[model samples]
Target: MKMKFEFQFPDIGEGIHEGVITKWLVKEGDMIKEGDSVAEVETDKVTTEIPSPKTGKIIELKASNGDTIHVGDVFVVIDTEGSAEEVSSEDKKDTLAEKKEIVEEENAGVVGEVISSSEVIAPSDEKEGNSASENVAGKALATPVARKLAKDLGVDINKVVGSGPNGRVMKEDIIKASKQPSEAEHKEVLDETVKTTVDAKEEKIIVEEEKIERIPLTRIRKTISQKMTQSRFTIPHTTAMDEIDVTQLYEFRKKYKDSLKEEEINLTFMPFIIKATISVLKKMPEFNATLDEENDELILKKFYHIGIATDTDRGLMVPVIRDADRLSIIELAKKVDEVSNSAKNNQIELKDLKGSSFTITNYGSIGGYYGIPIINYPESAILGVGRIVQKPVVKDDEIVKAWILPLSLSYDHRIIDGASGARFLNMMRELLENPEMLLLKA
Candidate 1:
């Protein structure tokens, strides 16, 4: 006797309501094993693998690749040798990198009507999805990053031949395919389209039709839009800008470059900036706090956890470094590299993106001077670091050359006044300008 096991798309946690189906790892009659990866789902924050809950053969897939599915929607089904059973607590998992946070939503276990063949429009429903390569229909076999890059560049991943191992597609393949059409060729194609449209209009009754491109927003983009709008409208923002001389900080990194290499850690100015921010936050605790609007109180945090903004192909992600006050500059640099890399590769834990008391956005690496960065909501302030450049300066009434770093600080004006905001920026400016000031405990 064959028993049916339904796989529902449970909420992957972190308040995510929906996800985009990126890949289907298994199709009908293809798998036999418990805990095998059945599919990959991409949320706004991360990409997660959907594991098979039982040892069985896949009978039907309920959603198509690239379909947007919601929490509680049935996504797949399997046939096992035992009697049918409801989805238990072990049905869904929220796996983010090595850190696995269990989905704690009440009754997250499978609770859905038996998926009929006519209910779902998945690739497997029509053809039984037996062919491994053809199972996902025309969807390309690429990693989540590669798929995102393809979508962003408007390239057809299915048409771009795979250059990766095991006939898998890669980001570079999509990039090269996108570059295949030159400007002249693109213009020629456009001209032909216009000419064809005009000839058709002349042949038949002319019906005015506007030509426009409509690109659907991804889950990440949607979430970004909502959060940014909420932050801008809800939070009263005030920005303070200033410049800091980083001549010594530059020399400091160069001086410690060799010794730290023995420890296998890269020396970047970010750690110095973080160290200075931590010291400044300690001196002025208000900078490292959250607002409790309902209670009308400032929720002051005892520990210093900093969120570093990382720009990825998917979107902007701020991965937190917990207890940054305890870590040394070298340790912070290593954590920085780990989190930044994990975030860009879509392997960062959701927990790493949470619990940020303060945020620092460093666009300096990309050559931006300064920006009025939005305060990551609930947090009182965000500090922005800009490009470092050598500029003429006045030192004791004498003209001198100094490496200057530009800074922008945006804070919640309701919680922090303009004068207090200036004080915080000045403190940060002083600590960063004089790198040794971080050594002072007070």
Candidate 2:
């Protein structure tokens, strides 16, 4: 007797509703163990590996690669040694009742009466029922659209007083609540009026708006947009910026390029930056943690798996360089080149991008001076490196030429504060300015 279990898509983060199947790691008839990777699911923010929840033979794949699957939609089926009837009678009863309740709710009217004919439910009457539920539950009862709007605007529905009939919350109510200025705005206005003398201030000027064109988002771009919106609204982000003098690093790279060429290795600045970041992260372990909201726990990683942000023709991809702490600078340079080339050619495997403990983005390659990169959710922080420029600096009370690299560090404020973030950035700067430290450790 063979038994089957359906593995539905799990919520990756926040309350995301769906994800696209980027690739399937296992095929039908493959024997899989519990916790083995099953598929790569690409949400709007990141492409993450989904593992097998139970050990069994995969009998069927419910969805194909590139197909969009919603939350609770079955994506895989596993066959065991028992038939469906072997499930306990109590479990069968519970399942049947749940199905019946869903059907009944679909067919029933707002007041609990069965609708006998084809008729549209009045929005007004539905609003009343929702309001009544809210009153009984002591929370705002909102439609899915209204809830999604509130989420995008970062508004708390409970604090928003509904203006619709029977106090049913509406999207308009949420928008109005978000638009209400805080007491700080009022204070600022009063202070401005007081500071400006009778005729000293200039007249306010209004500028006409320019026409904006809308473009459809690509698959990767769409995911980026949704994830960024979610991060901005859900997580409190604080940024720390610092500048490091990398003159010694520039000279060292130039000195070693020919030697590296002899070994068939293409040396780059990214590997050195990545090594320095991993070293600093090892010292500040809290910067390499994840928030397990369900368990109310913080997971700190001891090993370092660094994510290298690669800009490809398709989009932005961060392929991980696993165990960077253990690899030599030359080894790291080779791995970076391999991963980056793979990402550019679209030959990178899903596993190559998973299990990153930290991430570093080299915006300097494109001449960006500084940038506040988003925290790759589930990871505590990300390091951004800007272009190295020769600028004037004061040395021994005199100005001189110095090569400076601007660094931007963004972390989840809920987990780490400004002081810790600053310390982490400073340590990275010190390591980069003096590459000998990294070599000594190696």
Candidate 3:
């Protein structure tokens, strides 16, 4: 009772069309059961493992590592309780022939057949209009430098007779070969190669490639590039910059930094910024809305899902905090730590990265001053926070040092005017400057 089954690659996530095979967990002829993982695949959205549907022995793996497989394509074949004897001799022969054909097809472009001959052939004479460039093995032997010189002189090294030991081509041989051409067309080409008044030997020089390194973009990097390009091109972005005097807020955070640390909760300025931004977004509903281009309308989101832009080794990822308006500052701090760690470790879920009404990027964590961050499209705007530095400010006609935080607000010009954008940043500054007002309003 042997049956053959072809397993198709399923759609692992919504809107996933294709995936690259990252690894193979099972090979052909291996026994497996239902729910066993067969391969790990990376799509534009996420990386996950594809599992088997039936319990059987693996008969064939249709795709190899790094191959791209589309949804509904057969990726593997399984044999249910099938033995080798169950296959007839004709089928076995056919399988062997198919495998041989595949090997030949793959190697035709890159691999050459080795040819050997025992018969001896005499070398061509110089006056016979023939070249004695090839050896008994039918290939020219030349040093890399000689080959480079031949290339620069527009001379085919394979057709030039070398005078060195064992017919090894030298720089002098290449220069001589350039001056004498056996064929009329080749001689014309050499004349054109030496168009300058200088002699061929004096003009010939090998130009080496510039010193640089090239690296292929990873899957996450490609996705980030595509999304950023789309957002920048589709939206007309305008950034407004300002500085906030957060002397009181800085003192407020320092008082609770140690108390929160004892409870295993790390305190940072991000949660306070998040709270202030959320309060401003609620009042200015247009900031938390998306433009419906097809219908010519603005769709405002009722719920507060804030996106925190996190930097990881892979790239920048924005993970959303759902219902952020309902969470306290302490809860927001805990959730921020959890999601950021997950993104850095590559353990974050797909759902956690979507459904954000607005985003905030804190480049200040890494000592960046002010940056014009691109608005994460489909959302109307993004908030950028810069480093807090102590500087002297005139207070009561006297100079005093105060902590100043810089802010950059980028918004879509199609929906928001310059005045509206400035008002948004001013509201955030007011909330951050007064801790009592931020706690009461947020």
Alpha-carbon TM-score of each model against the true structure:
0.71, 0.55, 0.69
lDDT of 2 by residue, 1-442 (tens): 4577777777665445566677899999999988999998765434578997777888878666655566665678787546442323223433422221111112221110111221111123222223423443355544434555576556887677676645556777877876776777656645322121111011121223433232334456654555566566666889999989888998999999999899999998888888888777778888888877788888999888888888887677778888888888899999999988887787776567667888888899888999999877668888888999999998899999989989999998988988998899888877888989867754
lDDT of each: 0.71, 0.69, 0.74
**lDDT tens digits by residue: candidate 3, 1-442:** 5567767778665555567788999998999998999999875545788898878898778666765566665677788665342333223433322221100011110000101111211111112222234353344555434555677667887777877644555568877777775667654644324332212333334334332222334466666776677688899999999999999999999999999999999888888999999899889999999999999999989888988888987778888899999999999999999989988887878778888899999899899999999888778999999999999999899999999999999999999999998999899889999988999998
- Please provide, for model 1 over 118-200, each residue's C-alpha lDDT reduced to its tens digit, 9 standing for 90 to 100: 11222211212122143145444555455556766677777777765433565668767876876677667453332111121
Q: What's the count of clashing pairs in each model shown?
A: 0, 2, 0
The worst-scoring run of ten residues by lDDT in candidate 2 lies at: 103-112
Best TM-score among the predictions, by candidate number = 1
lDDT of 2 at 22: 73
Most accurate candidate by lDDT = 3
The candidates, ranked best first by lDDT, are 3, 1, 2
Q: What is the lDDT of residue 171 in candidate 3?
A: 67
- In angstroms, give how far residue 371 of model 1 lies from its true place: 0.9
**In model 2, how many backbone clashes occur?**
2
